[model samples]
Target: MHGSFPRLDIGPLSEYREDHFMIARFSDYVHEHQSLVFPHRHSFYHLVLFTEGSGRHTIDFHHFQAEPDQIYFMIPGQVHTWDFEAGMEGYVVNFSDSFFTSFLLQPEYLDTFSFFDQDSSNNVLKISENVRERIGQLFEELLAQNARATHWRDDMVRVLLLQIFLIIEQSDAVDRRKSAAKGKNATVRNFIRLIDKHYDKVRLPGQYADMLNVTPNHLNALCKEHMGMQAGELIRNRIVLEAKRLLINLDLTVSEIAYRLNFNDNSYFTKFFRKETGMTPEDFRKSPAI
Candidate 1:
């Protein structure tokens, strides 16, 4: 069991240089009582390598069981929470988005990797013992170089980081090829990715369809055919998922949450929420599963 921490806000990027990389071993302080890290979002990407313990990692509306020898990559701007049992060991590698775009953003390079694609649903990357040893060594080298102030230290750190991503790229190629062959249409996949990226602001199906250069009807038909649900259903699910997350994870009032979700009238939001969920917002918030 893990106790929740106060909501943590990781601030936006103040600098844009890709010269520095932050690597930390979380095992030093995270224990049973300290198992929960506050929900936070960062401007840079994070690669978390979990070596032991079991818990749930919640990112946006998605939740996954965390286990040993697993790697979780979180892109920029995704709010996430880490809940773990005692005695967890891991390396957290943090780098600016510019670092990736500068070095690995080529079409051929990106096409060779699946993990970086916004359309790919493969969030958790499993690591083999041999690969883990190699990654661990790279991380140690990064930490050592980052601690030094030599003129060539930054260059060395950047090179090492690139090497790490290159290795991941090779391993992720097979997965990407499989995903591409799955043959989901680009429009639907792009729409889903847009929703994941901008759902907080863009909630209307017509608006999304317009952005994708397709009619609302066509978009709805495609989603229903491929996902077994209409585009409207997908939008509503995202909204409700965010609502549930806010209600359960924060101390915000129902009315406040309704307003934040863009409901002009709090009562209307409550009614709509209950109509879909079969429970009032307040009652749903009080449920034990939360």
Candidate 2:
């Protein structure tokens, strides 16, 4: 039987302090973790722009060929693992949502980034060679500013990060336009955003339908059309994902995770976990591999 997936709480390579919001790297991270980066999910967002590489990147069980000038974005809870040849080079930026939301004037601005698409379908953006030079500079500055703390280092890095996002948005405008269904898919996007926000306390498709001001049937239809899954399935998937993250990374017990995720009883949570993952929570925790 298939078992549970384990999340690497500490980054496979490195991490800043818990309270700190972000970290960026150019080539050092890949060089340090020369071995396999175990299949793991992060609690923070991960953005990578590879300038040189040849191999594969596995995201949510899908293998994407590794290519230079390609960028990959992963939000929380998506499982990823990568393998590459000896001399791959890239820039990686890891951030917590609170990092920008707490400081930026527009707290909800992140929702507009096409790459962070909740369903993770368009997460990889292939960049052109012309734009690579400028993008690489942005990463350079972020690395320089983060190297040593000055009076305004954090603020400087924050501003630079915003610039990087804008550049990517501008560069990817054509791609977004190609698949853009702003009028129709907007509702589905809103539903996914809501699922990310409330999956723990609200799991019913009807609840999400009400939030979107559409009938449950309509909502399910839209989800199937856009995501190839029902709205309810997405909600349950999010909840189970968070549960798995907490179970594998934290010191919390099963009962504590059950309550944290709004399940009233441990038994029901166990049943739900088993139904979704094919293994009991205890068995999952004990497994040597994901």
Candidate 3:
């Protein structure tokens, strides 16, 4: 069985104070935190911009090829691991969930970025050649700002980081502006956030609709329009995703996972998993990590 990996906090991963923010060159970060090569979870926001590399990595079980100018984002609680060539180099940034809370009036501002949407499929982005250098430059500025304790150092760091995010969001090849506008819809965004918080206990779309002060049909229509799926599918997908994440940790038995997921019994959970993912929990656990 695969060994269970750790859920790392920012304090343990860096030599600096636990000031809720850390920045370093990718090579230095890797050298200092070699154990991160193993599958692990982070209790903070994590992002890496690969300036040069050739290998592969995983974000919440989704596989991605590591390449120069390719950047990936991981939110709190997502699992991540990387395997790269000897000459790999880049920048890595880790910040606590509250990193922007006090700085921004709207604490959920980061969620507006597609890359930070918590969907593994949207976690990675290709930095176009035009803005690649500028992105790297911003990262360099971040490294510098983090090293000094000058006046307003943290706010300067925040401004630079947001600059990098805005650049990526503006130039992303995916043409996310339209979808991003849709995502800003308070009802839809709130629905997704609710699902993330209560997926285990609240399993029904109708219940979520009730909480959101909307009808089930209206909620389903909104999800279908923006997320390309019905409301119920959104809930089920979150549950299946949690099952897969929990399955990666071999120490937990199927029954325990089922209980954690609010499933009544192991057999019922197996049936639901197979229906959604076409594999039993044990089967998924045994299969190779991709």
Return the top candidate by lDDT.
3
The lDDT for every candidate, in the order shown, is 0.68, 0.74, 0.84
Q: Per-residue lDDT of 1-290 in model 2, one digit per residue for the tens? A: 12323345545534542645555454676665554365677777888888885887776645788888888888876777777776777788877767777687866667667777554557887876667788889988888888877988888888998887778777743275524542247788788789888988888999989988999999999888866788878888888777766776445789999999999899999999999989898987776433
Number of backbone collisions per candidate: 0, 0, 0
Cα-based lDDT at residue 213, candidate 3 = 96
Can you write out model 3's per-residue Cα lDDT over 1-290, one digit (the tens) per residue? 36634432334564332668998889888887776776777778889998886899998888999998889998888877788878889998988888898999998888888788667888888998889889888999998888898989999999999999888888844456544744558898999899999999999999999999999999999988777889999999999988888877766789999999999999999999999998888888778863
RMSD of each: 5.0, 5.2, 2.2
So what's the TM-score on candidate 2? 0.70
Off by more than 4 A, model 3: 1-11, 14-17, 181-184
Candidates ranked by TM-score: 3, 2, 1
What tens-digit string does per-residue lDDT give for candidate 1 at 27-83? 753532253366666677777878777888776536778887777776665567767
Candidate 1: how many backbone clashes? 0
How many residue pairs clash in model 2?
Answer: 0
Alpha carbon lDDT at 189, candidate 2? 75
RMSD of 3: 2.2
Give the Å shift of residue 62 in candidate 3.
1.1
